[model samples]
Target: MDNKIVVITGGSSGIGRALCNCFIDAGYKVAIASRSVEILEKVKSDLRSEGHEILTVKTDVRVDNDCKNLVDKVIEKYGKIDVFINNAGITWYESNEDGINIKKHKEIMDTNHFGTVQCTKYALPHLLKSKGSLVGVCSIAGEVGLPNRSAYSASKFAMNGFLNSLRVQYLNKGLQVLITYVGYTSTNIRKIVKDDSKSSHFPPGYGDAVKEKGMMTPAEAATHIFNGVKKRKRSVRSSAVGQLTVWLNKLFPRLNDKLAAKYYS
Candidate 1:
């Protein structure tokens, strides 16, 4: 869709960055929003050098005003939004053995779940006007909880439910709501902790274990997202494992729980 505008949250790095490139290559006008102004400018400059023009907005999705301003800026720039991808999210890898870190849980929920809700609330009007798509870059954890990711899973589960409900609510309104279940990918999301003074609570050698297991690249995940949007697909899974996990959980939830525990452990 040449010149069709797509607004993405958390578009500075990782899958978000790759999504910018993918959409640009496909001839869409991409607008990205993130909390980091420096990273936003860098990504904008880098893309500008490649002859692709994009709009960047400094947005903290947890803030209602910021989310509203993000949509306002994109509409001001492009006249309309053809798609809005709620991709901004954070996770905590702490275990329940230490008791839930209520503070960290709130932070993750604010970023991942409430962030999606706020953005969607602001973007829905424009999306409805354009008969556009609303996409959530959710996770397999949303479908099946994993060990040591209680907060993250809860956030995604909330996101999944919210988006799914919107999908049905607007089914007769020519709106497309897509929920993408992303599997383990080679992204820095896991290693990042909300408090820079502390380190992630992942078990020792977790990085090495991830490396040994292998994961999808951000580009691969972006490609899947782009294709899903292009096709107006209701849902997509970034990895076959994620797809299987959703199905297995549907049929044999208890067995899937054991499998999830073993995989994460």
Candidate 2:
């Protein structure tokens, strides 16, 4: 994979950042996209000091032109794309008691679902040409809805469906689509919700609950995702818990529903 090119969005932090390091260690050329120019520069500088080179692009995935420019820039630098990871996403914590916030839901959907779609649209041709992998960093919430995560769940479900459809459509076309169902991971994603007002409504102890010791680290999650992409897997569960939740939901729908409610509560 030394000469192969990999593109990752949301690449300045968390699992995305870990993935950049993982791929670099494996000798693949990496290009990262993020909305924050400062964060991108910082990551680039840190990696450069460690003797790894990377291309950084300022991109807001929610914008179509930005997504297009991201792919264009990567192709300009690397000539071809071997893997494109749709990892840019956001979430909110809100309960039914907090009242439905359509605006918040739309905001999440725009980033999580539509952002993935836009990036895929521009990157598809390149991926197809190289028989490359297209990956979605989805969540367990996509497999089974969780309480207080209506917006996040809906967006992920949409993403899952979209990626699944692409996998089928391109099955014989030599394009690989991989969806990773990630469970709770030690990432600051939860803390970066754009809506402070709604995030403040998170139930007491919710943060502690999510930060339990068993949660996977971003590096661990990145390893799972990297392996899946390397093997051209159709799907991967990032944790034992995530795998169990998906299977239980499939075999015991109602029971899983009740368990999900209790767990999130």
Best by TM-score: 2
lDDT of 2 at 110: 96
Overall lDDT per candidate, in order of appearance: 0.87, 0.89
lDDT of 1 by residue, 1-265 (tens): 3479999999998899999999888888999999999999999999989898999999999999999999999888889999999999887777455667889889999999999999999999999999999999999889888887888999999999999999999999999999999987766676565334243355323463236246888899999999999999999898987788789999999999888777665
- Candidate 1 lDDT score relative to the true structure: 0.87
Ten-residue region with minimum lDDT total, candidate 1: 203-212
Over 4 Å off in model 2, which ranges?
A: 198-212
Candidate 1 scores a C-alpha RMSD against the true structure in Å of 2.4
- Model 2 lDDT-worst window of ten: 201-210
TM-score of each prediction? 0.93, 0.95
Alpha-carbon lDDT of model 2: 0.89
For residues 148-200, what per-residue lDDT tens digits would candidate 2 score against the true structure? 88999999999999999999999999999999998888776766663365544
